[model samples]
Target: MTVISVHVPKTGGSSFLDILRKNYGAKLLVDYGLEATTALAAMTSGEHEIVHGHFVADKYVDVQGARYITWLRDPIQRLFSHYQFWQRNKFPRSPFWRQQYYNNFTFEEFAFSPAVRNEQARYLGGMDIKTFSCIGITEFFVESMELFSKSLGMDIELDNLPQHRVNTLSKKGYELDDKGLRAALYEFHSLDYQLYIQGLEVFKSQYSQVSGCLDTRFWDLQKSSQKSFPPQFSLQKLLAEKQVSNVIGTYYYGDGWPINMWDTFRRDVVDEYLDEVRSDGFNTIILLFPMSLFKLKSSNQKAHEIFYNDLVFLLDKIRDKGLNFMFRLGYSWDGFPLSGDRGRVAFSVLCEGSSKDEFIEEARQLYLIAETYSEFLYGFITWEDLLMFPCNRAPKASEPMRIQLATELGFTGNSGAIPERDSGEFLGYLEFLDIKFTDLFMDLAVAFPRLSAEVRVDTTPYNDSDGGEHHYVHHRQFVETDCDVIGTYFATYMLPEKPTLNDMKRILSFVHRQLQVSDPSKKIFIDQLLLVIDESIGKGYSTISEKVIDAFVKWFPEWLDANSIGYATWAFCDYVWDVIFNGTFRYGPLGWEFGGNTMLVESAETRYVQMESGAWLRGGRILHFEPWPQRGCIQIELEVDDACSITVELSDSYTVELDKRDMSQVSSGKRQVITTEFEIVPEYLKILINGGAAKIYRVGLGKEISSCGGRDLNMNHRVTSRLIRELNNNYGGNC
Candidate 1:
């Protein structure tokens, strides 16, 4: 039988032809005729074992004893290699080169050219794909060749075959980094991309069955090949173990999406964004599932299937980028925010008259879906909407309604058995709601013990000093429940402008004290910390300065590690409409403000630096300083302008309760010096200037010895770090 190797350009055709020449010697037919038809005719008259040349498979369909064989490649990579090859071979002396070279084509132009667009599919156009005796991949050349040789009964020596890498870019340079150009190229050759993906699936199916025939030596060659070209099957790098300090992430808020359904199908857009996320040093992404999936009104299984498929696709992409996914299950879609039919069904479970079985089934389905992706799944955050107060007021449910809620939650004995909501036997109605809230979490905790089912609560009136209703009592009751992780939706910008610095300190202290008093061992997670800066809110900057970013990076981690394993920012990327700001009331980059606070720009550049121990914050309106990571003391020399006031506080342990005391304050036009002294080393320090202006001349961490006996007890060992270390020891660490 005569072997017909149809040469698809840039699919290792030339290299395979070289191998054929080596194997067959004089008997190999190497384009003996000037034209394809003439070549077939020449093959008929000769004693040739192989006929190799650039020709379509259809051209030789009628030829007797013709067996077609070819190789394929990843279309995007092939096109890139093709462009680079042409650019390298642009010789002015040759006529073909002179014409093309004078045109000075870009890689984009060459990629979009009609001559080579989807050229492989076009070359094999009319023939059934299975008709070819062996179709191989250029990426996995060794494996493909082994399969090709075995199928065709050819003597291809794996050890001796020359693997020539022609016109290849380095691993990093291989990808099309330009988002716009990459997008244009993908759109232009969308058909080829689909074919390539299909081909990969086919190749994988064939590869597994052919394993019985694969020589032991073939894997040895594969291992060697991987040293340079890397195996095609493994695209993503193995994820590294996350550091205690750098495990920071963001809530990919589905509600903030411009449309209810995002075109996550766009490979170029998603790839670019994921790369940006990886570059930002985040190891986790919390994908908030849209509430449309849970809506009782629409049981569109097709829509569910489509979304699940999309989620799996996005998860694969996320994993390939070496990031873990935390599923935030069942939040309402922004287009139809969980009201009416949807809201009623969800709330009925939490309210008095509802089916406990329906609620359990809902939780069960979410748990099952989560289990399917346990490989990449890190944890889960339960629906946050359950904590909403009607009309933004406390305890809309009356005492009778609260009793009904407790009954629904299966609370035994008397509601009076629980502590009163307030000291005076007044407002005991609110305490009943907390009891129900605890029951809901306890139910989920028992059902999904495998994952750390974190409950994210709203920390409204962040500080008790506001004289408004404080939710700390509710928070204390919730943390005391069986929740695996404690989390809250808090933003520093929510504090009053005058007491911004002091209020932040108080909020953190209250949280720490609650954690210590309840169960210090429980892990905490800041589900959302807004990173925005608005001039209208006295933020006074269009974009954040390195100083502001530095202070946040330096202090936020210390604050988090004191109580929790990690924290996440409010958002990663979002789409905005009309004006950037909705009103004169400018706000920070939290999800609630400016419509969107995308951490990454379209180009994948970050608005802030990745913070760590060695991170620096210098040269801005705020002075540079080293933070007392262990010893929370701070000393500052300030130059206050006329009518300006400055506020400063140290964040240490709960025992200090610095918020209850006021020591340092600076007034206008005077030089003032202040030093903080607490019972223990503080983990964070805050400074805010109000009125005209103020300049921090110098600031630095305190070197004074700790009086609390040792480093703050809260941070002696990180819960996340220990957990990861144990996981790594159990399962081979990386990836």
Candidate 2:
């Protein structure tokens, strides 16, 4: 059998040929620019093993028992490289270059030229993608080689092959100059783009089929070869730490223009806050990139450039701060209208009407953006509340709007007779939406397997202490979607009283069991752990002074280590600060600030408590606490700045500071007043000042409130009663 290599120009064909030659040696039958069909016909008996050349698939159709192989590339990049090559080499002797047509043509003109448009597809002679024994992608050449070598039943030395990044045009700063031309070229080569997309699908399918034949070490080698931006904290170093407590991080929330936020972001404030985060022992930050924002500028070169530059800037800064970054696509909490942009309206309309192809295409564009930045990306979370369907009611639409959305979703029935909420048709519509989202999630996971792509759902039912029914539909969707990570957001506390460290573990254990049964492959995680210091419940309630933060800090790491799931605080900063500082994200009833929840209790002070002697302690601030039932003693932790005499005292009484020289004995470099009995117990404790400045880490209140695993406490009765009444009123059930 003859092995035919169809060498598509500028698609790593030259590099591939070098590998082919190394393997086939004298048995390789080369055409060397001669008519490939003629060369094949002229090949002697020994040369029958391999007949490789740059020829269309048709040229080899009659060659008896020939197996064809080829490599394809991104059409736009390939075209740009082709143009740049001619400009650089003057094609040496090509008739077109000799005529100066290549020299005179602009890239835009060259891109759409009849000679090269859709060149990859043309080279294949419109043959079916499956016609080839093997197809590879130039962009992922190493991975392609592994598959190709396996198919050929040979050991291809991939490491020995030199990298081929030939004739790359002025793409480095193309956006700065002739920005519109890139968009023009993209439009001009839409056929090539579609062909490339099809080629990727083909290549991916082939790779999956032969992947089991690959050596485990060979897969590792491929991973080592993947391009990575230099990280402030290398993934190797971060992964080596193996401390579950380090995983406690928060999604950034505040002050940027959410609509293209990077355009006018406050990097200095973020830098300061991130400095606080690092010092506080957090390791990751999540950024939101809206699909509509990217799609709205699909053809706008300037917008694309701005978005790219801003994203790069933010990512680099995050790296500089030694914080890992994850991103969620589809919606930016910024003021981008849900239906304002054409893409959003298109997706929303399509989703409502169930236009699968259009919605998938929209999702494809979004993932393409992810692919571009996959090097810096750590993971992906689905859009906030995307899985919360039926919960989020679509806006009331005018007759025209309803018709438009209905028409877009491909509704064929009478528009005026659209199914009502309680109707079977409407339920079917919801199910369709669920399935589409699942498909979208699975596609991203497959397309970008390197990144941790997953869905984060509201797992409120699983964490609830009320013994309510779980969101069965939501759970089913997540399980069927098969996301890489199953992230949960306990918007409100699952338990009525503050969940103990043990309670948190129990909650997560139940969740893990559920996910393991559904999809054992998915990594379970807690995306949002609410940090509520003091919450009120109607007429009667309970307050746990500072133990909320304490219990979480103390027990969370153990929970993470035991279950091997990641955890992040609800937010790093207050939600209201965005409205106050940036005046963005100002939607009433939907505003984040309206519900106050964040890790940062006060403006700049992060609630970081050091775990020492089985207690979480915080330093450097005035202390505030409310005795749940009665007054109690305090345990104070202080870090002094300098050698100075001082007095430590509560508002009701005082205690003289210890010798400054004795501070040397304090481990972790902080002085402590462990279980210091307060003579007069006040309703609210206060740390009165004296001489030297001290960082007050913690003022642990004793005898405030106690419970049985956060159930049947002072606040639990009030909350349980209210919740029972609410549930009965809503669903007409007895408690």
Candidate 3:
């Protein structure tokens, strides 16, 4: 069917064009010329689905099966808006009748002009107002579009249609408020007023027939789009049936650090790392594999062979060591040649193209290979890679890729431009990404049976039309996953740099609550429990203190016992490359060295109590502070007993003593923060007790001290090893 959209000026005609274009794509014709009648007469109904332009409705009235649609506004407001728009843009291509007045026209001159008066009626010509298939009201824009779609059967996505206001007037106020001017304008445009009233009546009658239909369909689509895949087996039930204890594990990617471990694979090195992992009291080892490795067309064939052989070798070794393991399928960290591109090309092929089927088939084949080590396999962790788009490029460079992705995800609209972040279309695009991510995890779950999807707990910011910003947390990946377990990483990046013990508790509690609300049936796991993270791998630079590490190690397992199934450290052993470090146990036992006599207490909370006067604990020392220009203040949180003064020393230069006088006077054991600033900050920080006993809880260094708390403190091998050993002894079951 051919549709003629008569675009009356200043009546939302440009916005209507977007809808027409989306519905017709290349089949939509624009006839903005002075003589549209000639073009209308020459065009065939089969050639174009829609002909939209600033033309009269009478032009296509005689065409076979041609229907009409147009938008109308209050004639007084429409004329003033048109005049204001002309004053601003003075569009050179405007109709010849408008060209003479252009920017020189005043509101009174434009409104009283005989040529501009009854302009809407002039566009209608001899055609009856009631003959239009759809007559949209500018005031009721959204509702009009809904009605238009239903009335014309135009295949338009009414819910996701974007508003496209063109040549908008910058004037804040219109002159129609003047009663005298309004009365005179109404009298001058009497013909248009009559036609607008008729069009409105027709619109209301047609809209009433389909009043609640759009809303109902919209809600139905929203409900259907929230697809969930429930796992065949419950993780909690499986753990109990297997008689396995809680998962106490750590991440291992060989000695080459962030690079693919298989590239530097050696039997002796693998054996040594496995031995240390077991000795550290970890019952499980979390291994990482890039999806690109399974892509048949990947250029690194030698790497693929080595990866397969090394994986089998490591799995057999893990079983021999009587340890359980889980595989983390990473989409972002493919390493080496692909690392620069962040595996975007491989991701597009495996997850977004026809090769997705092939990828899944190959994944199934890999699952079959792992079946030989099924006895030692706990599950696979779908690292938060699935939710990511290859967004490493500039927005302009990436827009085409995003558009192609939108098309692949079933967006039928012909909009070539990127949608605004807050637009319904962009949100729909994000929704489609979530659906695709969920579907991919579902496929993996079907193949592996026991799978865990690592969900991102961070919220993304969106700006509203009012220019106010708000955040939206995506829960679809977690809510719709068929994976038996839902996994997430824990790091200070999720909290303030100097978070207190309570702050840590609140953030984790919120994550736990959110996960429960997302899907109450699935069990939760901390796939990467980062006790200490380097600046290279995290959102910001930070250092973790031994006190903080001890506190987390003691509290996290107990908290997990009540809130989740288990957790694994981000890395068990540190891997260094140039200035970058990977794990907490980087300095062996030296990372936990204390400068003075301090008694370590591991009762309810982990802390260091002063054994005698002048006893001090070295919080953390940065040997090369030159690289970190942001380090400025030293902050320490501790409990001071009455009459006991604790001295916080920075690089043995700047010092500040805090006694009970500095306490908030709430309670005797209440934790108080003593922050000391420095002009030339030093690399080392220490806390010393003078004369009496005090409990040191946490210590940190940052650009500035904000409310006194921190994470990413330092810890050595001896400290972490003992902490892990104790956690496993207490939390680990049969494994």
**Best by lDDT, which number?**
3
- Arrange candidates by TM-score, descending: 3, 2, 1
Candidate 1 regions exceeding 4 Å error are: 1-246, 253-268, 296-298, 333-345, 352-359, 372-384, 390-427, 451-471, 482-484, 498-503, 535-549, 577-735
Q: Determine which window of 10 residues in candidate 3 has minimal summed lDDT.
A: 578-587
Q: Which candidate achieves the best TM-score against the true structure?
A: 3
Candidate 1 residue-wise lDDT, 574-691, digit = tens: 3211011101011111111111111211122212211122122221111112332344444444555454443443332333221223223545456555545544443334444434
lDDT of each residue in 1-735, candidate 3, tens digit only: 777888999898887887778778888888887465567655663677788888877777678878888888767668777877777665565574354464466678767877687899999877888888888877667788778877777676656655443213222335344656555665677688767655655765577566621222222222322221123567777777766668787877665444434433446567778887877778788777665555523654643554566678888888888877777764445432232344454445324445566556656656777667744455553434544542222123456765665444333333643354545445444444454555455455567666667766653355654655544344454454444567776766676665666667887887776667745666778887775522333445335555665676677777777767788877776552211111121112122345566665543223344445678766332433344544455555567666566666665567765554344342456766665555654545566778666665445454444432222233364665566676666675332
User: lDDT for every model?
Assistant: 0.48, 0.49, 0.59
TM-score per model over all chains: 0.39, 0.42, 0.49
Q: Give the lDDT of residue 130 in candidate 1.
A: 64
Worst 10 residues of 2 by lDDT: 577-586
Task: For model 2, give the RMSD to the true fold.
Answer: 23.0
**Sort by lDDT, top down from the best:** 3, 2, 1
Error of 3 at 218 (Å): 11
TM-score of model 1 vs. true structure: 0.39
Clashes of each: 5, 6, 11
